[model samples]
Target: MTTKKTSIIKVALLSLLGLILIAGVYYAPLIQRLYFSLNIEDEASMPENLRTLHQYYSTHLIESSATPQPFPRQLQENVLPESFQSHGETIKTKAFFTDAKPTGLVIIKDGQIIYENYWRGLTESDTQFAFSVAKSITSVLVGMAIGDGLINDVNDSVTKYLPHFKGSAWDKATIANTLEMSSGVEFDEDYSRTDTDMRRFQMAYLFDKPMEDFLLSLKSNREPGISQGYNSMETQAAGFVIRSVIGERSLSNYMHEKLWQPLGAQDNAYWNVDGAGMEVAIGGLSMSLRDLAKIGQLYLQRGRWNGEQLIPESWVLESTTPSKPYQMPGRDNPLSEKPFGYGYLWWTPVDPNGREYYASGLYGQYLFVNEDKGIVIAMYNANNNFNSAPDWWKERYEDFFQAIAQKY
Candidate 1:
């Protein structure tokens, strides 16, 4: 009787082991993300981690046109001012270089490069990480898709194109909702936390999971449009919708044909891709500072460059200006990524500087455009205080730009 019981136990254990193996294979990507969490905070390797991080990730090259666009040069010999006033203190030009940790700065006024500088082992040619600024790029593509009639309407439900989302809670969410970060999806944007939805996204990406599969696996934490949540996955969903609508066309290729080539980009760009081989449309673009400024110019020019209509003017205004219900969220009931008001993947500040918006990424990548002033400031940094810093740096950059604009 004892020998018979031992044999039965062995059989049960073997069956359980087989089941566990099957489950592991199915959940391998999630497991890998958990494994990758171990190195989330390890001190970055040399010259700056972004440069190396770019080397480690899966990437796709976005080619420039055969004839690159050239900005009319009126290079000012002395680009830096003696000092600029910030928060009641005088921050000298040295502070921007040493303290602010700027890697590149390109100032364009009246459609010409007035000042340009590169540092931190970076050059005008080096394709620095655009980070979240890539979201703005992705936003433009949505506009293009609309303009091209690939996407019928912004108000249409996301499930209209990506049928996979039909049974999901996002079925009712509009493309506009995702663009404005009002999707109400349960995705945490915090990169500092190992268990954050952002890290889970990275893990899924590393493990080669389809971006859509990862996005759809999420649950609806709140009713779509009932609240606003600033998460990368929202834009990821937007990109997925674009991919679904276009079908077989790569985002990078579409960008090359529509904007990169048309705008006459000076250099070829690279967009970070996922293991499933889709562009990381939320925040994975890397390009030279000059080309980034060109993107800014696309907006500043009211979507027209060199007299060619690249992005529609109406779309430009609609995207930057705050839309009601979805975009102009009430402060007392505030739920946003930042204190700043948002409009279609762009950040809008409460500054009394009148109406303005800019594209910002976690790594201090910024493309500031003062449309009224016809000024575009493209600044890139590898700041150590990313997401942990106070609002001072942003305010200081604004102060510097204001001072620079007045001088010019």
Candidate 2:
């Protein structure tokens, strides 16, 4: 063969090798973990819990082939001032939005819709994923279960509902501990690596395995209620407790009857389910940005809507206020970094100057409520990249809240 032909063939081979290497890296478990970390599934829908999972999944994750109806424009058209603009200029210039495009933004003030916008093919009718914000919603459901006497009390041991856990480490963990994220389970929340138990838990939910089985596999790293760790598995366990207490009601059905329909949600929302038809209460919820804003407004009004009480007034107050101290096992708690404390599943900003608390999710999904100023902002973004730096969300959230505070 000619020398020129040999050189060309060698270059082609090297190019092919590089392409394969790139493909492998992109499709590797590490990449999958990154994606899965942002994707929350209903633990009950897992295959091992088939009957429960099937029932939950069918009711929650409804995939309508038909187009979804849009929310009333009047619901959001008058909330903001005519000249008002979001921190869009800052967001566009920032590296965060450049990497992760926000799909939706909705702001409600004084029970009035003010501003709404969508980006990157998302619309007012689209049900954007909630990520970990579902944890906050799950917390609400737990409170509802308590009100209905489906569950006795927050202090009740988890094993009361799931007898299988009677002798297990979680047997003594109380519903309050899980709700407050004080469960001292021996699981890592680290997402930087793919082999961590966090990923394994994600795998369990993704592949539809029993969440309790996954929790049972863990050894106690710390005594229950002694420390705080962001254990997603604990949230799954909380879901199980809710199911066991509520008996036959699917998570979606409960939410619809108790919260959604009552709040006058403009559109149907979807929640991810596990193999056993259990709703993944930790964060697999998906709903329109406007509906999410309505949730914020509901909380802002202390669980009241249209002069009626949807959720217990006391439950809303306690759930939004910080209950546990901000301390982790070996690390400084991020909640301490702020002026506010940690509540049921909400993050209270420490700035005493700002009455702001939020339901924050992986990436940039936030349901920020500033009750004193009567402002509620719901933002949805695909920011899986920001999961590692949760503080990143706090910074932006504070900035936005500060701006809104100025407006009011």
* Top TM-score prediction, candidate number: 1
RMSD, one per candidate, in order: 6.3, 10.0
Give lDDT: candidate 2, residue 135. 91
lDDT of 1: 0.77
Number of backbone-clashing residue pairs for each candidate, in the order shown? 1, 32
37-103: candidate 1 lDDT, tens digit per residue: 3543233432255554555566788887788977888998766677988778987888665666778
RMSD of 2: 10.0
Clashing pairs in 1: 69-264
- Summarize candidate 2's per-residue lDDT along 1-408 as a digit string, tens digits: 699999999999999999999999765744554454343332322112211222223237533323332333435333433232233444422454455456677777677666777776677776766778989998888888887878888888888888888767686788888877676667777867888998888767656676667778877766787656677778888888888876677888788777777676767688877667777787788777877887788888888877887778888888877656653111245533334356777777645345567888766778888888888888877654565666655565556555655577
Which portions of model 1 show Cα errors greater than 4 Å? 1-48, 77-90, 325-337, 390-396, 406-408
TM-score, candidate number 1: 0.84
